[model samples]
Target chain A: MERKSSDRKARAPSGAAVQKIELTEALYRALFFEWAEHGFSALSLERVAARAGAGKAAIYRRWPGKLQFADEAVNALGLKMAAFGDKGSLEADIRAFHRRLRIVFRHPVVRKILPDIYAEAARSDEMKAISDRVAQTRRDEAKKVIDRAISRGELPEAIDRDIALDFLPSSIYWRMVVIKSSLSEAQLRLHAQGTTAALKSLW
Target chain B: MERKSSDRKARAPSGAAVQKIELTEALYRALFFEWAEHGFSALSLERVAARAGAGKAAIYRRWPGKLQFADEAVNALGLKMAAFGDKGSLEADIRAFHRRLRIVFRHPVVRKILPDIYAEAARSDEMKAISDRVAQTRRDEAKKVIDRAISRGELPEAIDRDIALDFLPSSIYWRMVVIKSSLSEAQLRLHAQGTTAALKSLW
Candidate 1:
């Protein structure tokens, strides 16, 4: 059976697998950037094709339209576990989260893409879907930290876990967007550390 | 002094002052929202003229262009003191700040204008200049609170005052824009209390 199987030829790789593969991350980044810069109203197939050094038909083959392409690009930049810390303490976890947050917040893509996505989300279901998918994981990870504190009796029994999770991130973002300050390393650490302490009673 | 005042009045308000005198707060708010929504791309003499219920000639007579109008609106909406309280302790004072912040944060103008201003600031030097003017007072006020805490030994001398200020508001804004979760009264108190406790050691 092994000999026969080894001799047998396999089928060619499917289009979905091929679609998932990119020749370079740069190409992926270029596509994400163009979409973020222009948004749905201004984004065009020709422009993305030009930026990525690919033919319009190539992108069309992988994505049905600009919306689908956006989904794929955002997925490539999705949040991850390493983004937050879990060193058996809430303070450590929050510090890790802010470090990751500062990186993301300072990224040109986030500055360009986030506002447009937010504005468009108010009007477009497709964009809203993409926004929710991208944000869900980070929020969930934050909530998990709160839950762990509660489980370990590190926080008070009556604390509201969800609200506690939101405290640090919300403060950072409000300053970034509304106040438009240059975010320093010290600022990030203070926000993380201070918020962790403030909300610990809830655990 | 009376003669000086009469002479100054006889000279009439300067061009800018005359414009300010003519503009009502509601009209100012409407102009601000319109400019924020459209940027320079969508703004025009006719639109603001219509929104303000004035003729095109009236707005042109005052602002000269959308940019000038935008400049005035930016200055008009700068951070307001939402009342202050001497609550007899650092925790109470911090809590008062959060209460004021909640009011400031929830204003439709603040919410709508900020993200747009941030996005524009990245691209437009003029907007950047105007946004900085708007943001400075808020930063100063926040710093004042930290200074008060340090004086009372509520926070450690080693605490970086600037770092302490950014913690709560930044986190709150992040939750507002990214999560679309309303910052409730309960959340504000929780964040305020938690962050103050964390920084208590530094006091």
Candidate 2:
């Protein structure tokens, strides 16, 4: 039976087969739900397999371990960058970013999953590295927005980029996550304006 | 034997009371170490008792359960506002607050324990309430510094108190915890100055 199964898998038409892709999607979706519900430390491959209704061997075949599985599962959820478009002005751009942030935070899966990831990152070096890489990528993308503002003469040339980079996200994260503040659309608008004003004053 | 032991315990002098106090201290210390190493979900009274070389009954006698014990243990470690003495000027006061914050973050125990608490708070409602109460207390204390600054004419009357209250700690927390930035003394000073500048611009 083992030999026949191996032969069938080897003879599969192509590596990117539709059935395999569907199975992978099912597994990833299951893994995400498991993570959102139980968090990282409680997460196990067996649980994920059971949740996905897939075999443990199939999961192990795709990802060697839990960390690798979690990394890919989270990434597949678009955990990296917000879909930010240019709004032509610094204030508008910041508002758009904040609006996107509010939407992201409001996601049912995201709110539950992100805190788990953050907590895990705090405890585990591997998770920290993964989180740091994601943060750095996001920061780089945000830096482009600042650069555009600087070029447009909205922000002065000598403004501190490092502090500027840290401000918006940090402030928003602190309010939304740490303090658990229920900010309305108007309040978000005010926050965006305050942040942009702070940035302008940095010159 | 039980009757005789109870009779003897009832008749014990001040020495037994002192020994019990010492044992309680030892247990709390052990709990801190266990929590630092294992986080809240993994913490158990049995493990803590064994680590402290105390009996489980002794732990039960002192605190009804794990939550109470954990709460007291964390509180005993001073998970509250730091000692921020008034420095008269807005710059001096802000800098003093930052310096104290750096010291708090630098404590070996704090670095190990805060992440666990944060992680636990994310998952458990009971833990979240405890953490929120603690956060609220600290925020109220921080608000005093801002109030003083406003009263001292450093920040204008029209300044948004809410955003200013959120900015310094949130920014510092983002840098210290999220980014894990190892800030130098000079960097902290610059951060303090920039925060105060931002507060000023809020007017």
Best by TM-score: 2
Q: What's candidate 1's DockQ score? A: 0.29
DockQ of 2: 0.39
TM-score of chain B of each: 0.76, 0.82
Which pairs clash in model 2?
none
CAPRI docking class of candidate 2? acceptable
Q: Each model's C-alpha lDDT?
A: 0.64, 0.73
- Candidate 2 local lDDT, B1-203, one digit each (tens): 12333565678854664235678789989998877666666677899999999789988876778887887776776777675656898878888777777777776567666655665676678788778766765677678788888889988877777777777677677777666677787667667776776677665
- Tell me how many clashing residue pairs each candidate has: 26, 0
Residues A90-143, candidate 2: write the lDDT tens digits. Answer: 888888777767776776666666656665676788887768766765676678
DockQ per model, Cα: 0.29, 0.39
User: Mind giving the per-residue lDDT tens digits that candidate 1 earns over A95-186?
Assistant: 77767666667766676666666655544679789878776766777777777777777777778766676674666665565455667776
**Ten-residue stretch with the least lDDT total in model 2 chain B:** B1-10
Q: What is the lDDT of residue B107 in candidate 2?
A: 66
